[model samples]
Target: MTKKVLYRIATLLGLIAILFVSTASTWYIYQGDTPEELL
Candidate 1:
């Protein structure tokens, strides 16, 4: 029971981390592109 709970918690944390990384990467790319488009 403890193992299953730990696994679920780990999976949730990993997904959260992945989402955070994806958001940051997308934001960074968007910021880089907007300057060129404006010019």
Candidate 2:
């Protein structure tokens, strides 16, 4: 594959990973009983 294609794939993977992490963290935070528990 070309360098440009590889770079795009890497960037897309990074974005997907970040999105997954944020979504998981948000789910966990909301699952807590109180807002204070988030701290």
lDDT tens per residue, model 2, 1-39: 699999999999999999999999999878858667656
- What TM-score, computed on C-alpha atoms, does each candidate reach? 0.79, 0.77
Candidate 2 Cα RMSD after full superposition onto the native fold (Å):
3.0
| Position 4, candidate 2: lDDT | 94
* Least well predicted 10-residue stretch by lDDT in candidate 2: 30-39
Clashing pairs in 1: none
- Candidate 2 has which clashing residue pairs, if any? none
Per-candidate RMSD, Å: 4.6, 3.0
lDDT of each: 0.91, 0.92
Task: Write one digit per residue (lDDT tens) for candidate 1, span 1-39.
Answer: 999999999999999999999999998888754666667
